[model samples]
Target: MPVVLSLNVAQKTAPADHARVGATGIDKRPVDGPLRVSPPGAKGTAGSGVAGDSIADWNAHGGDYQAVYGYAREDLDWWQSELGTELGAGQFGENLTTQGIDHTNALVGEHWRIGTALLEVTGPRIPCRTFAEFLGQRGWVKRFTQAARPGAYFRVLEEGLVGPGDEITVVHRPGHDVTVELFFRAVTTEAALLPRLLAAGDSVPPEVVELVHRRSAVELDS
Candidate 1:
């Protein structure tokens, strides 16, 4: 019964001298189906298995789909409280701000419906230098990585327009044991949790699994 408390969009704008490029402007759009376009700055080369039309592209670049990257919403107050600031105002790198569910707990392959659009939770966001630039803090990337509460990223299985104040509901929770957070941790901190994540029996994407395996081996050797 989670609802979208608010939606926002970034308009094209110049990046701050040292500030990471946040989305240009925040606005409301319609959600009609799965696989929406990835927001600007997140697009990949053609046929990268990434739908480049909507907000998914931005997400692929380690941006949050809802709160900090595309739009800003208050529904993510918990993130602010936990991080001790306004996350949507540019703390968490989200696009669409949401409420009701803990994004970190949302697993891969899970489907969620917001308004008319359906999105499948695909993975956890990986922190990057952009995040640190946006936050104006050194070690911001490491801080987020160590926090282990990476937000969820989604792929549009159906395409549709979405806007602010829509209702976001879970349509399906895949019965997979591996979770988005675990997958993220496995890749980021391969030495610590990779084995456990593999043992969890969750369906991990091949790219992610391989990344973790390689890193894990390096850690063991060191």
Candidate 2:
């Protein structure tokens, strides 16, 4: 059964490097207490859904659509081996470092019940310059994208408190086969896979749905 291996919250601090703005919360640390979570409105106006956690880049991170981040421990382990480095919980800036679930391949729109909260898998966590800088790796963004193992992002549907060791129950899964990996592939390296993302309907990002429709129209015209 899937479980929350660790619950991490960001410890906001001044820019860790020149790659970021005034401050950044990319270096999340594991927390033992229950965390309050809720919808954080939108991207620019919000910080983080997990109360006490911080978000420095209002333009790029945090919002109702990405209220939570879940990365599988298995993937982190893989990265540790591939990068030859020691990575701990929250290394990837994930709120919930999970175990026992194929989190990276989780289908978009799947609902999960962890603790007293209900969350829906919304999209794939895109690798950003901050992430690359935080990892201190060269071409890290390209490498991460190539792996196609980007962790899944979530939106809290029913707000509540959650903590580490909580069992993650997948309450529902959309019928479509739009896994996080597929979503990443469609939006990034493989443009040809975009059409298949249409099958996900509204489960994916609104911009993605609109892009698919626009592309479909262009193809029809051609």
Candidate 3:
């Protein structure tokens, strides 16, 4: 039942009100047919793993770890209700807009077989100033942080083609309960949850685990 409702790619970029001075690839549009998915190398080098998609802000946006961004259509509908606006696919700049998938509850290190490409969940999308500017909503960052439906960034495990309407199969799911929502909370508002992130093991990025250890050391010293 979990299928990709739409496959979106950034069509263009222009000046924006974000930290990235030149442009922001936040305006993504749904595309037809198969789109290639592969590792986009590093942040400064490659941008989006989805072929034809663009990433304007490389310094903090794209990399092998964040090859693709996925968001749930269900969550978008919820936001529509909250904001009283009809949101189209890729409105949140997601590469894959899926239906029937609980992205918020999806665990880190989860593997999804979508079309021919394989993707692994890496972390939650941290809302930034660009997101706020794109949405044009007051206190957007705080609201999104509190809502905790930040979506999830994915790493391409196997390069292949992906398209809209493709069924998403969960080929693997991590044993840990470190869901994306939990991870976002840990790094954002809920500092106490940081220690619990260790339960996720290497499923989450090493920097996250290192942060947990550093926090513990700081706590011990103080």
Candidate 4:
């Protein structure tokens, strides 16, 4: 059974040496109380703008399709071994640090009933320059990408309050073989896997669906 190991939230803060010149909410810290969760907005406009949470980069951080991010403690343990450093909850900027669920094998469109909220697994977190900078790690983006264990992002289907220790119940799963890891691979280093994403249909977010179609078309044309 999956469970929320920790809940984290952060406020926008001024840029650090590595972060860009603007507020960044990636420095999330563990919270002791229940935090409200909701869908920020549709697609490109969604964010974690619910109470007590913030999204610094409205252009990139939040929207309907990425209302919350979840990373597995198991995966974090793996990174801890490789990086030789202690990583606390939300170190990866995830709102919920989870345990038990295999994020890599989480099927796209899987729905989780956490506390009073319903969330749908949308995709995997792709490594970005901002994320790399947050870690202040040399070649962090390349390293994380090669590791290929990026955690999951979710869209809020039903809003509610959630806290650490909340049980995560899988309420539904779309009948697709595409897992979060597979989708990430298709969009990143494995272009050859693009076409298979279509089998998941509308379970995948529109933007990525479009990407897959475009890439598949190019592959065929070439």
The prediction achieving the highest lDDT against the true structure is 3
C-alpha lDDT of all candidate models, in order: 0.53, 0.87, 0.89, 0.84
How do the residues 1-222 of candidate 4 rate in per-residue lDDT, one tens digit apiece?
789999988865556655454567888889886888888887555458355776777666678778899999999999999999989999999999999988899898899999999988888888877788888798998899888999999888899988999999998988779999999898889988888888877767788888877876887899
Off by over 4 Å in 2: 214-222
TM-score of 4: 0.93
- True-vs-predicted CA distance for residue 85, candidate 4, Å: 0.2
- Span of 10 residues, lowest total lDDT, candidate 4: 12-21
Ten residues in sequence with the least summed lDDT for candidate 1 = 45-54
- The C-alpha RMSD of each candidate to the native structure, in angstroms, is 5.9, 1.7, 1.5, 1.7
Scored by TM-score, the top model is 3
Ranking by TM-score: 3, 2, 4, 1
Per-residue alpha-carbon lDDT of candidate 1 for residues 9-56, written as tens digits (9 for 90 to 100): 333333444433343222223333233333222233221122322222
Q: List the residue pairs that clash in candidate 2.
A: none
Give, for candidate 3, the lowest lDDT window spanning 10 residues.
13-22
Residue 192 lDDT in candidate 2? 82
